[model samples]
Target: MSALEERNRRVLVIDDNVEIHRYLREILEGGAEDAEFDAMDAALFGTGAGPIAMRFDVTSVYRGEDGIEAARRAREEGAPFSLAFVDVRMPAGIDGVETLERIWGEDPEMQAVICTAHAEVSWNRILARLGAPQRFLVLKKPFDAVEVRQMACALTEKWLQEANLRQGEARTRAMLIAVPDAMLRVSTEGRCEDLRAVGAPQLELDDMLPGQAAVAAREAVASVLAGGPTEVFEVEREDLGRLYEARVARAGEGDALLLLRDVTDRRRAELAAAQRQLHEETIAAQAEMMLALSTPLLPIHEDVVVMPLVGALDSRRVEKVREVLIQGVADRGVSIAILDMTGVPSLDAELVDEIVATARAIRLLGAESVLTGLGSGVARTLVEQGADLGGIRIHRDLGAGVAYALRARGGRAARS
Candidate 1:
């Protein structure tokens, strides 16, 4: 054992007689040839060899005042005496009762025995003065050595046990303080037995959760006690403008534990992400609709097709136009395809190339392509860009293109 553990086994002896202090020291701190050990060895083994002695550090004081001072000093040094033997009738200063009162005020865990030859004070008066029946003992003067040793061993063990209990309580308090949610222990009937807000600084039990919350919490607790699953509910505080998620679970013996966690920030983030996804989906649908309107293919006659170009025709829209024209010619099996640009606002070199490319694509599909709705500005743009519309028929409007396609088909029929 460390010296500190040995020091905790210390005893204090308070008496006016100098001889009483000497006797106690010899008995508590046993010598090599101690009479008590020798007697024990003789009884146990029928031998006179002294047995192993147990030693205790004993402090001696002549007066009650001096004994109280010694006890105070031991407490300050963190190595307090586990027990004190105080004489009831000390000639100087306070008596045993008064000295014990002062010493216990400083260290209440210190056990003590009153040493006296006469009953100078009544037992009721002594109990009234000390107010600790379990911690106080009475030992007549000229006490037995074996009784003293037993008292020292038992009281010291009791002191250590009580110290351990206090340390455990302190650790529990620290753990509760470090937790970041509001907690409550509620009975089966939903009565709040204990509540702690160690980490929730903003929570006010009185004002934050009042009548409605108590009712709801009790209902949740009832559900869990009925062998139902754990329950969770949201509580919104309009005054505080915050949201809390309350969880209730059975905690044995007809009671439940409630934990409330704040989740307003998390809820807001989820809402924002959902709104962004919806906006992107809406924009995609609108873009698809606009692409369909930009390239419209309609059959005007038997084996004839017409495509009208409209709006701003960027490179992306031009590619969409080419796809629609080729698919329409194959699906409809057209012999003549017409390009209409009546609704087009303006034309550039890029747009002129796109138009010429569409006409060439139609010819490659074994169909004659007729260009109609050729405004002066668009025709001039096609010429300036040197776009090649090789062997492609041109008309002023959609009416003229349809009439010429019918006439050409009639001429072919007559020849056959």
Candidate 2:
């Protein structure tokens, strides 16, 4: 940009001197490609500001009364003046300072430059009346054209910067309020500058209050301010039908943020998973037990395994029982083999023949068979069916049968 364009020119000239008005407008508005102009003569005093150019706008007035009136009318029309050149020595209707006050009331951002040559009009007097005089500029009557243009251009840029700053602040505040979570602003000095709770519920923090004002529910804030590692703390409350657990955490330096979600569902899911694990273990144990019982087993101890035989003996059971007795006797190295028929219901002729063959089979294998679950009725039926048991020994119960077998073997030993 050129020196003129960088100034961003928009000039409002208010003076009683017709030549002065023309001079101020000419010097302030000329040589700008994007500036607006409303050049006015003394006769055009009370006309309001011109229409706002899309880029910039400027207006001029003749008298102080006319300037104040035009300022009011420009404000009503929503086209604010940016830079005003006010003459100090005006007629008694109003002076430059009073007009300056009214101009600010209409548009607070308008920058004014007091144009004067009077020694009696002190600097403090005009400044004190115009509120914060540093915001304005003052040029003497004998100033050159370049000096007037410089002052006007500087004030115009100053107004634009001020307007930009105010708009930026307004936008920032709007964004801050739109956040969904609670936000806190603190300094490193442990001073809380601001706190805004967006979705947090109102709590009875009378007892937990910090300072004198509820301690502000700010553990997370305190953690951040102390330069500690960020941490999460759970606070449970039964406020809902079920329990609700709140997880609070520190977010960043000088700031703490909070997000809340219900975790009752997650807890229940964990519990259900544990129960399913236990049920699976139980099923595995039951399967192991069935496997142990259904399959045959080797004898585990040096003791007898008394397997009593009952109902009609099938050939499959006869073979299984024979295998159990022979293996048990051989493994334990025991002396007696007693076949006590105490509960046999109705032995098949062929099955009885198989049982005797099994006992003989046990003898050959260095062990013996003992069948103890037969009754007298089964014995008689076995004899009537012509089942063969001539060479095998039998007994009603284990005691008498073992005694007879012992004596008979002893007699054979004595004879030998």
List TM-score per model, in order.
0.61, 0.46
Question: Which tens-of-lDDT digit does each residue in 233-266 have in candidate 2?
Answer: 4444444434333333455655554443446677
lDDT value for model 1: 0.80
Candidate 1 TM-score, C-alpha based: 0.61
**Cα error, candidate 2, residue 71 (Å):** 2.5
- Provide the lowest-lDDT 10-residue window in model 2: 295-304
1-416, model 1: which lDDT tens digit per residue? 64335436789998898988888887788765676657878888886354345577899998888888899999999889888988888878888889889989888999888888887667788898888799978887677989877777777777777787888877876786677676777776455544544344332334447567766787888899888889999888877898889999988869888888888888999899999999999998899788888788887665777888876678888888888889989888989988887877668898778878878988999999898888888888988888887789989898888789878788553344
In angstroms, the error of model 2 at 76 is 3.9
Residue 312 of candidate 1: its Cα lDDT?
65
Per-residue lDDT value at 160 in model 1:
70
What is the C-alpha local distance difference test score of candidate 2? 0.61
